[model samples]
Target: MLQLDLKTTVFLASIMSALMSVVLLSAYHSFPRSIRGIGQWVAGSLVLVVAPMLFWLRDIAPAWISIVLANGLLLAAVALWTLGTQAFYGRPPARRPAAIVVVAATLAVTWFVYGRESYEARVTIVTFAMGIFFGAQALLVLRHGGRDFSARFFGFLLAVQTLVVLARGMASLFAGLGGQTLFAANDVIQTVYLGSYTLMDLGLSVAFMLVITRRLHVELDILSRTDPLTQLLNRRALYDAGQRELAHMAEHGGEMALLLIDLDHFKHINDSLGHAEGDRVLTAFSAMLKRELPAGAHPGRFGGEEFLVLLPRTTMAAALALAERLRATSSRFFGRQVADLTISIGVASVDKAEHRLDGAVRRADLALYRAKSAGRNRVEAVMEAAA
Candidate 1:
């Protein structure tokens, strides 16, 4: 393997970062609109690459380009990174604060280029700003972003980067940083500082990609298990939960009951009030179920106009009362809008020996059918369901 020095490492790192940014930018365009902040990240990464390249060209470039322009772009990139971090987590960016910091950093650089030309002053200002913005990004990740390993790692990296950058800024004053540009570093401290910055670039890029991919996977899993309309667990998830609940009941002696519920006159509402109104009714009823279900109830959408709830450590009488409450609430709520809007509920106590969700559900479903036959707006028990 070829040996590399600080300058060579920085150069290669910049190139790699630029390449990664470009690839990510292209990928950002391909990502769904549901994923936020990719555009800001893409733009910020490009600006970030430009900052270092300009720093490297300090000897050849004009003071305005190297000092003012480079620092401005660097701060801009940090602002964008903060914004991107917020966006990735579906949170709003701290625009006013970021804008203030960017302006301050750029003004400090402008003063260095035009007035005092003091490298220490410029470095202090820029590094402090970087530390603050990096800290802000770390906060964003921990606050609203994913709690997965990759997300946590990214936040930790940002926190460490913040401390290091701030320490660099503080140490620069004591180190007698006279006129040392980023590239023309004479001491070990400057070289180490630059090296750390390069490593930060590499680490954050990899961490953020992992965070994005992991979050998407989590969201896809949720989408698969949940019904889009009612925001309830879908049939698969319901059955899965039922199976698990039964297993738990086998181990721990607990009474388990199933409630098979159907919206009464739902087809008529869809036909008379239109599908849009019917959808609203479904959503309202879903909200009601969420509010009215007993504590620790496992509610799921069984199918169209049908829902199931599993109640563990609950009696048939308690289940009946809860079902009655749901029916009364539904009647009072939907009755005003549509006269015949009501729900039929059927309760079936799961037999300890049966050990199956399907068998329990079948009994509850028969009870539901009985409720439908006997005037459509009442609760029926297991025996009533059998008839």
Candidate 2:
């Protein structure tokens, strides 16, 4: 049987960790600026790898430079990982707890070395510190990530690592102390500890890259389908969703309603208030649609200053009411937020299979033109055609 020793596992893991860090850091920098926190994750992995490598040098170097330094670096690495997780979920990085952990661990390590030669005490305190940091990193992911699968998985991984570390720390109380050094390549307990640490930290390094990549993919997907300024589904997404809903309603049997909404004098607002403020108007109107639109309504940006809302299982009168609500919400925000910002909406109702959604949208567009002609900030309903 081939037995794995502490130095062998630690050295191999260190080299692999450094390589992984380089690749991850390179990829993170090459990615678009929208995806945040990859840098911190890579840096943390690098520090973690270096910490173990430093431990391997304990026999040749001073205890302060080797054991204490390695433990301090390990704490720093956990802090970086926690900070990265915060950034991953769009939360501000917290520094106080990390500072506290580093300070406490440093003091403990200093006292163990200066006041006494109790290696067990020194190792026990370091284990608890590492466990605390690991637990904290896990909590950061859970708190900010909520039920997100990737985030939860990463947090769970940290929790597992924490359990292993904390168990070792407590187990030390009952285990017999001997003359074996932590870095002794042949020490059984040392080998077990180093092997477990290497495996767990390696898993963390790999997991971080996976989570970052998944986040970047998700962000790219959202960016592709949504309007950048309004954060609403774009015209392509609107058409796709409309087609899907039409198919769904065809099978399920429901009335499908389409509303074409045009911001009243949107061009005038852009020219008068500048495009920057005009963007604010569009964003505000999109927010109102999100809040006030009927339940299950899919609101999308149809074009410049124009939006499309699809409501399923709706009657003509109900569709009209929704359109009026939309008009009112936009009109109510006029003068106070944006200069005279209001919307003209055209409502069209039809059975799911009566005609394609594009045809219904065209009819709704015509009604919207009618609303603009009659007066701005009003809803005009296009009646279902005779069978």
Candidate 3:
């Protein structure tokens, strides 16, 4: 059997930690700027790389430098990991509290190093503090991270690392800190502790990168499908979704409706109030659609100043009522927020024999043209052929 010594394990762990830090840095530079938390993770991994090197220095350096400062770096690394998790979830990183905890833990380790020189006390304190941070990471992921494989994998790693750290802390109380000096004993507990720490160091670094990559992919997907300014489904995505919905309704024998809306005199608003004000109006209308649209309604930005709404299992009458409601509310909203603006909506329902979404949209477009031709700020509907 090949035995792994504490010094060899620590040295290997330091090398691996530095390599992982490089990997994270590369990913941060290569990936989109929208992905968060990689910077903090990189910072933590670099700190971890330094920490094990100091541990390897041990007797060559003073106790305060090798033990206290090294342990302080370890605590700081955990704190940074916690902060990274928070940043990934778009939550505020309460830096003051984490900084306070790291400072206090370092002071406690310093006391054990110089004041009394008890290895057991120092190991116990450091392990317990580290366990706390690991536990926090796990809990945060469980609460906020979505039900995705990357999230679960990362959370599980954090949970297992927490258990390992806590077990080491408990073992330190009974195991007498390995020997007169730290890592002096070649016992089973010490060997397991060092081996597990190294494994976890590598595992967690990879896991953090996985989480960041997954988020980057998700952001890119959303960006591709959504309008940049309004954050609604873009024209292509809207058409795709409409086709899918229409196919489903065709197979299931259900009615569907389309509403084509155009903001009246939108160009005038942009030319007069500036494009910035026009964007605000569009964003506000998108928000209103998100809040006011009924269940089973899909709203999208078809083009500039034109929006589309798809209503599944809806009749022409119901679609007209909904359109009126939207027109009235939008008039009031824009009146208060921007200028006295109004919208014209054209509604159309699917024919029982027709399964295509484009036909309904075309009819709705015609109705919208009529609405604009007659006057602005009104609701019009083209009945299905069956009706």
Best by the lDDT measure:
3
Tens digits of per-residue lDDT for model 1 on 203-251? 8877888887777787888899999999988999988888887888889
Off by over 4 Å in 2: 140-153, 184-188, 338-341, 385-387
TM-score of each: 0.93, 0.91, 0.95
Shift in Å, residue 258, candidate 1? 1.5
Ranking by TM-score: 3, 1, 2
Task: Tell me the RMSD of model 1 versus the true structure.
Answer: 2.4
State the lDDT of candidate 2 residue by residue for 134-157, as single tens digits: 887787777766576776778888
Which is the better candidate, 1 or 2, if ranked by TM-score?
1
Residues 212-298 of candidate 3: C-alpha lDDT, one tens digit per residue: 888888888898999999999999888888888878876788888889999999999889989998898899889998898998788
* Residue 356, candidate 2: alpha-carbon lDDT: 62
Candidate 3 to truth, TM: 0.95
